[model samples]
Target: MTEDDETALSRPQRRLLRRIYNGRTEPIVVEGLAFLTYKEASRYLLTLTEEAREAAYQEMKRQAG
Candidate 1:
């Protein structure tokens, strides 16, 4: 991914990356969406449809404020 793509990820997305890559195995939930595994969630966050990505972004924004 480009630097701009990396920069575009939300705070929660970064946290998820850390959690997944650092060997955290628990599922994660965001905005009512349940991720059964970090890899699964990471995949969704990185390569899914725009609607899913936007939902994640909005959820992160909501949590931040």
Candidate 2:
């Protein structure tokens, strides 16, 4: 961020921005609310590898049997 942008941000805002820039993949609590970084949200995507899906399917079928 530019000097002007930094100057405009509160201390907590700057801290949160720094954490995001440094690739922190956890929720941050502000006031009483929790916020997830973009990196953390992306980690929750439902995509799975083919091998992983096949293994899970086999496990489920085995359990059903």
Candidate 3:
């Protein structure tokens, strides 16, 4: 698949992409949430409600800045 053609990817393919692109060998902890892998963190983000997702993004921004 092309780099821009994410819509065509299956869930497993997406997870694999996240694992490769995230560049983290260990689990990621963000806002006290612990993920088994970057792929898991990405999957968790997808499950959040819109408000919660925005809140998490804002928190990440705050920490980064």
Candidate 4:
């Protein structure tokens, strides 16, 4: 209810406006759909069978070196 209380809230609120998500980069954007989660994406892309998905999952984990 006081100016001091209002000013204190404004000070911290100013930071909320200044904070922008700057972690984006050109490499990821150029890759196209890099942000898309691989776990779900692969399921839609590969419809061979659950066995194939399991094999692909194993292969992905193996190749992640």
Candidate 5:
């Protein structure tokens, strides 16, 4: 993202982006749309089931370990 784009995101959004990026090596996609920014992905993440979130967390740990 450009400097202006980075500055446009709120602190929470920036933090969310960091967390999401840390968890995966690939862009998040939902229903065929690619989520390259926190604004686009946060809603989808918020809507995930607990089981799905846990699965994603496990995958992140697996990748980290």
Candidate 6:
């Protein structure tokens, strides 16, 4: 690696994702949506209330059982 290469690498392309989150690149299967990006998916997940989250968890558990 040279000075020129280092300079080029300094400017990194920003990803379309939440910087604070531990993210996955795969699609998130929500109620009726397949969110392609963690950014979009994370935002939608944040909007769901605690009751909605619990209901979803119960439904998933029931299906698995």
lDDT of 5 by residue, 1-65 (tens): 45664554446645756676654657665455566545555445445576664454344334334
Best by lDDT: 1
Write down the lDDT that model 4 would get: 0.34
Task: Kindly give the stretch of ten consecutive residues in candidate 6 with the minimal lDDT sum.
Answer: 8-17
Residues 1-65 of candidate 6: C-alpha lDDT, one tens digit per residue = 33453232112211212332235445545577765543454455445576774454344334323
Cα lDDT of model 1 overall? 0.59
Tens digits of per-residue lDDT for model 1, 7-62 = 55667767755555455444456757666554555556777567878787456434
lDDT of 2: 0.39
Most TM-score-accurate candidate: 3
**Reference-based lDDT, each prediction:** 0.59, 0.39, 0.52, 0.34, 0.53, 0.42
Clashes per candidate, residues 3 or more apart or on different chains: 0, 0, 0, 0, 0, 0
Model 2 has a clash total of: 0
RMSD values, in order shown: 5.5, 17.4, 7.4, 17.6, 7.9, 13.7
Q: For each candidate, what TM-score against the reference?
A: 0.37, 0.29, 0.42, 0.32, 0.39, 0.37
Better of 2 and 5 by TM-score: 5
> Which digits, one per residue and each the tens of the lDDT, describe model 4 over residues 1-65?
34553333234432331231123222111113332233233433244465654554444334332
Give the Cα error of residue 26 in candidate 4, in Å.
15
lDDT comparing candidate 3 with the true structure: 0.52
Q: Model 4, residue 33: what's the lDDT?
A: 32
Model 3 is weakest, by summed lDDT over 10 consecutive residues, at 1-10
> Relative to the unseen true structure, what is the C-alpha lDDT of residue 61 in candidate 4, on a scale of 0 to 100?
37
Q: Clashing residue pairs in candidate 2, if any?
A: none
lDDT of each residue in 1-65, candidate 2, tens digit only? 34553344345534544445355445554323343553332222113354643443344334323
Clash pairs, candidate 6, are none
